[model samples]
Target: MEDRDWLILKTIYEEKNMSKAAQVLHVSQPALTYRLQQLETEFNTKIVHRSNKGVEFTGQGEYLAKYAVDMLNKLRMTKEIVESMENKVQGTLRLGVSRNFARYNLPPLLSNFLTKYPDIKFHLITGFSSEITDLVYKEEFHIGIIRGNNNWKEQKLLLAQEPVCIVSKSEIDSNSLPALPRIHYETEPSLQSVINNWWEENFTQPPFITMRVDRIDTCKEMVKNGLGYAIVPKACLTEDDILYQINLTTRDQKEILRDTWVIYRNSSLELTMIRAFIDFIKSIKQEGV
Candidate 1:
């Protein structure tokens, strides 16, 4: 099949619905259906089936979809290579970033980068650090920015190391932390584990959690309103917030730090765009942003 056919299969697999795939592919529903029928006929088997949820791919369809994804990635790489031969650093930079970073840090960083390399396009996906790391590992993204550590063998660079702290609306005794109202927010599992471990190390009793929120910003607002205290990375704090902040430390008296990392496969650096982008990020860190 042609590259267009591969793209159609890949889009169908990703969208999981004929109409949605049609919209993404910028084709009519009838045209997409005809294309799928043609693919099925060419393969001499049913490619997909309708389900209550949406379209479900058969085993053969799944295999073809995987192949289609590989083909698309290779095609993209080839194009990038050809373009780079002319000494141009321009291409789509697919990046997966943590939600917190996306909300707070990414805008300025992207603004500066895009200003410098106007030809470079960005496709950003934001989620939990764990989810972003998975996307990077799956080669779905050329780069990933995540909070916390990874056990993967891919190349990783430390972007920043900020302290985790006890934040509250009013001054609270660190010695009596377990007795006070605690505000917990759902975050990356690794971060939560670090906070839990720190708590377990210092206190015999569990925290008196007053509220549980889904977002870090919400947790910060709750603490700012005198609701409770939360243990979060320092990225949540700003100079404008007049909150009581107590930096955390381990039992051995080392600072409790939260790290943000830039991760990518070494092989991906072959693309001039990715290489330039990585260098740009490193330069920003060097300039102490």
Candidate 2:
């Protein structure tokens, strides 16, 4: 089958509905149907069974979808290889980045990189660290930048380390933190556990949580408004903000820190674009950005 046919099949398999796939592929429903019919006729097998709810792939369809995905990946790699022979790093850099990092940090970094390599394009996917890690592991992204730690066995580099601190609108006695109306936010499990363990070690009583928010930025805003106190990574705090901050530490007095990491498969470094991107990130890290 042709490359376009593989793309159509892959899109259909992902969307699981002809109408949605047609919309994504920028093709009319009738045209998409005609193409599917042609494929079925050529292969002499039913690819998908239609229903009111959606379409379901038959066994042969499922196998063909997998084949299509492999073929597409090979084609992409081959294209990158051919382009790299010209000593040009011009291709899409697929990135999966943590939502918090994407919001707070990625803009300037990406802007600088783009300014330097105007030919390179980016496809960024923002999600939770766990989701980003999964995407990187699946090779869906050339690289992933995530907060906190993960069990990925890929090539990983520590991008940055920032202090995790307790922040409030005003200074308060250290002993009173356990009784204060603490603001909490949802974060990666590893970071949550670190905060919880720190609290457990410092005080016998649990935190008097006043509110729970979905994101760290919201938690910081609530603290900024004098609603309550929050413990967050240093990146959430601005240098000019007139807020009370207390850097946290383990019971042994080691700093409690949040780490940002760039993860990729070792084999992916062979691509000139991926290698250049990784080196760019390293340069950014060295510059303490």
Candidate 3:
């Protein structure tokens, strides 16, 4: 099949919906269907089957899709290598970052880096730190900016650390936390583990959870309205937030912190854009951004 067919397979596999894939590829649904039919006829096989939700791939289709994704990755790598050979730091820098870092830290850092290297482009994917970790392992991106110290044996630089803290609308006795209403939210497992461990350290009883929310911001709002207290990262709070916070501490009297890391494989450094961005990040760290 041609490059476009490979892209079609990859996009269809990723999107899991024919219409969505068509929209993403900027092609009509009928056109996409026709192309798939052509591919099936050429290969003398049925690739995908219609399902209630979207579509499901046959085993042969799955193999072809996997090959397509690998091919696309190799193609991008080829482009990166070719661009590196030029005396310019220009190419799409594929990055996977945690949603928290993307929301709070990435914009200014991207701004400054782009100011210096105007030709460097970005293909960023942001999700939970856990998801980013899996993406990193899949080698879909050159770099991953993630929160928490995860199981990465490859090269990683500690970017920053934020204190883990408890927040409420008003000050309350530390000893009374177990009895007070607590707001719980869904977050990465690592952060949840840290909070759970800290809770176990200071309290003999379970938290009196008043409400469960889906996001950190929702928990923050619940705390702001005096509904309950929540354990969260200090980076989630702003100066304008009129909430009382107590930083969690370990038994050794050290503050509990959530660390952000810039993770990348050493082999990626062969690309000029990768090296340039790494250097830019090092400068940012040194200058205290």
Clash pairs detected, candidate 3: none
Write the residue-wise lDDT of candidate 3 on 1-289 in tens digits: 9989999999999999999999999999999999999999999999999887998999999999999999987887787788799868898998999887887778988998999999988999999888887777777889999998698989899999999998999999878998999989988788999999998998889999989999888888888998989988888887778999899999998999999999998778889999999999899889988
Superior by TM-score: candidate 1 or candidate 3: 1
TM-scores for candidates 1 onward, in order: 0.94, 0.91, 0.94
Better of 1 and 2 by TM-score: 1
Q: Residue 87: error of model 3 in Å?
A: 2.9
**On residues 181-224, what C-alpha lDDT tens digit does candidate 1 reach at each position?**
99889888989999999989999999999899999899999888
Which segments of candidate 2 are over 4 A away from where they belong? none
Write candidate 2's Cα lDDT for 94-211 as tens digits. Answer: 8999887888889999999889899999999998889998877777788999999678787999998899998899998867998899999998787888889888988999999989
* Candidate 2 Cα deviation (angstroms), residue 105: 1.7
The per-candidate count of clashes, in order, stands at 0, 0, 0
**Cα-based lDDT for every prediction:** 0.90, 0.89, 0.90
How many pairs of residues in model 1 come into backbone collision? 0
